[model samples]
Target: MEDIPQKHEVINWKLEQLLVFLQYCNYKESMKGPLFYAKILLFGEYGIIKDSKGLAIPFNSYKGALKSVKTLTGEAKKSNSSLIGLYDYLAKLDTELVDFDLKSFKSDIDNGMYFDSSIPQGYGVGSSGALVASIYDKYAINKITVLENLTRDKLLKLKEIFSIMESYFHGKSSGLDPLNSYLSLPILINSKENIEATGIPSQKEGKGAVFLLDSEQIGETEPMVSIFMNKMKNEGFRKMLSEEFSIHTDACIEDFLQGNMKSLFGNVKKLSKVVLKNFKPMIPSAFHKVWENGIQTNDYYLKLCGSGGGGYILGFTEDFEKAKNSLKDYKLELVYRF
Candidate 1:
């Protein structure tokens, strides 16, 4: 087993973080800086890759912020090292849409800057996306600010820029994750080219809810995505993805946005069933039984949260209490209430 940090070591680390925060305030940048929140793809996970509709929203429960310390150790030290690679990638990037203050960024990284983030890596809640957003927010020159009117053209431009920037982390990225984290708003993807800021129905004080089921394992995006791509090569898989997966995914997005609960659940059930039947590799093996149990019992419906070999599995249920009882063995985190 990995050795845990001693209590005193933890305290010293916290003190170093506090000192760095004070130094950060003394700098010309905005105080405390801006936090880049993790994002959740509420609908259209795999579907979005093929130009199907997608809806992603900021998940404030987990977020990342850029922090600096004169000296770094442990996790922060590791994060700083990773940032160096990202910096190297960005420094050589030749893009007209976006450019970074590579000198200042490198200076900070050399002086012990790291992402102090609560978001868990490989959980599909956009840990790398948050990191990418934070880097762009801090270093990008003449970057588009969220304050400005986000025209369709501008949104697509941002997505394109983010796509290239974030490709360093994931071999191929849709860029939707970083884009959603950067804007910190609900993003609706009509297709690859048509994306816009969208509004979701406000949460209501009802029993029906959306929740995250902890799979107690981290999921690697690249491998799972490779599996998806390999599967796409099969004509039958392509047909099912377009005809069945995309259709139900699109309906779920629309129904969710419009707050058509009855229609939404109905479509979600179908979507869940389709995912179970088709995307078995994407769903964690341990979860297959429960995934089916939800569908069979109507207690809750399970769907992939991101690539989903493991990590948090998205669940929807008419009764949160019943779902909780049904899923008593696993950890549940509430995301949205109906």
Candidate 2:
């Protein structure tokens, strides 16, 4: 729509190819969709669940694409089989309220069309959200033009659709993942209903680096969330979140946004401590000592890169060399500089 080829061209070419193939096969119309990389929440997790400000940025290391195939194989077959139930559920929804070319959609599924993505599932990287966004973009009828001036109401509607679509993966969805996928911009999630693209502060010249420490284990969001929900049932957990978690989380967001690096690290120290104290269950048993040592020794501060448990741990260090020396046992991926 903006005379740009990179984004629209790929989607359009794929759609045309599918349609031509359909015509040759005596099938229905063709639709196109864009794929996106997964995102990592640099900050805010359980804290955001309580309505504290959260920030997420696209992590291009992992990505997903939508393409129609005549057959599936191995894990792809199983994944497709699992998603059929979800597609069927969506088809049964009120037709007038939501539009989709169900026949072609189902046909693709029957023909073994599956999403081929590198984004690790349950790593808090928005893998399922990318799939959902791709489906809606390709098949939804009278789809909202993404190029149009997107209003608050439009954003809400999109979130609702994404929530339904992503439910197949997470059992429950905050809808932030798919929202970030569709927009391909950094999203600031203020509340479940209040989210928007926000500009991240520029990096500074310093010896420190903000990095992701891969736990080398896949983290299942559902199980991790289940664990948190159970923890929340305890009054002490709730009190801790209300008092320490929220305060530190809010301060961290404000400080980062204002480019107050010193203040941000200070708050991050508190956040790292709170996370270590309260989220012991979510942290890997093997990493417990390391997590505690980082906080107690002030060598580095570890926070949730996404949903914790496993995947990657967000880290802040005043001295990269010192932190690296201290965390030599674990693999670390640098994401930003300070």
Candidate 3:
């Protein structure tokens, strides 16, 4: 990390965020302004790419943003280093559509600017997506505004731009993560060709819930994705993916959107079984038993949150308290109540 800048002059917060920043603590706004939250692919983990339905929502608990710190330290310094690499990557992208203000980006880095993130890297959550969104917000020229009346074509264009920007991190990317984080809204993906901002049923005071079971280990997306790609080559696997996997997944999406909780739970149980049986490699060895136990006991059903080699496992239950008591030994974090 030689020649790394140690000092920086912070910029004023964006006009829209300044009022809130003044009332809240330093954590509320980035030096450059608003942060992007992490996102969870509530449904459609791998099936989405295979032309299945998907739903993604912002996970406000973890967030990241571009910052100009007086003294870089620890995670901030590491993030700055990564952004410098990103700068080099963007500088070489030979495209008119994805152009950025590279000169300002370089200057900002030289002035000790770094991405300060609370979002955990390699957690199937949108950590790098948040970084990419933050960079585009600060440096992209003629960037699309979230406030615009987003048309289908415009949304696809944004996803394309984000795919190019974020491909540097993942060898290949679909860009849904960044799109979800940038919009900070639930996105309903009918398929690769159809996507739009969507409204989901609001949370209710009920015992039923959807929660995340932390794996406590980082899972690299590249390798997990590669494994999936390789598996897709088998004809039997493709059959199962379509007949069993996508069938259940599509049903879950339909039921959830229609607010059919009774049917949603049933579809989720089947989806969980399909995932556990066929996507075995993605589930961590430690969680395999408990994942199955939840299904058998009807306490809860666990499914892959994202790529799933070792990230948070998404769980659904008709009764949260019952599910919590059933698996008392492990940690669980609630994401939604129904």
Best by TM-score: 3
Query: Which ranking of candidates, highest TM-score first?
Result: 3, 1, 2
For model 2, state the Cα shift of residue 156 in Å: 2.4
Candidate 1 per-residue lDDT over residues 1-338, each given as its tens digit: 99999999999999999999988767535323578999999999988888999999999999888888777999999999999999989888887888889999999999888998999888889999999988888899999889999999999999998889889998989889999999999999999999999999999999999999999998998999999999999999999999998999999998899899989999999999999999999898999999999999999999999989898899999999999999999999999999
CA shift at 2, candidate 2, in angstroms? 40
C-alpha positional error of residue 324 in candidate 3 after TM-score superposition, expressed in Å: 1.0
lDDT of 2 by residue, 67-160 (tens): 5556678877876776687688787776344678888888878877777788877566788888887888778888876798777777777877
Candidate 1 regions exceeding 4 Å error are: 1-32
Candidates 2 and 3 compared: the better one by TM-score is 3
Residue 154 alpha-carbon offset, candidate 3, angstroms? 0.5
Task: Name the top lDDT candidate.
Answer: 1
lDDT of 2: 0.79
> Compared with the true structure, what per-residue lDDT tens digits does model 3 show for residues 176-290?
9999999999999999999999999999999899998888878888888899999999999999999999889889988988899999999999998999899999999999899
**What is every candidate's alpha-carbon RMSD to the true fold?**
8.7, 8.2, 9.5
lDDT of 1: 0.92
**Deviation from native of the Cα of residue 171 in model 1, angstroms:** 0.5
TM-score of each: 0.91, 0.84, 0.91
TM-score of 1: 0.91
Error of 1 at 15 (Å): 23
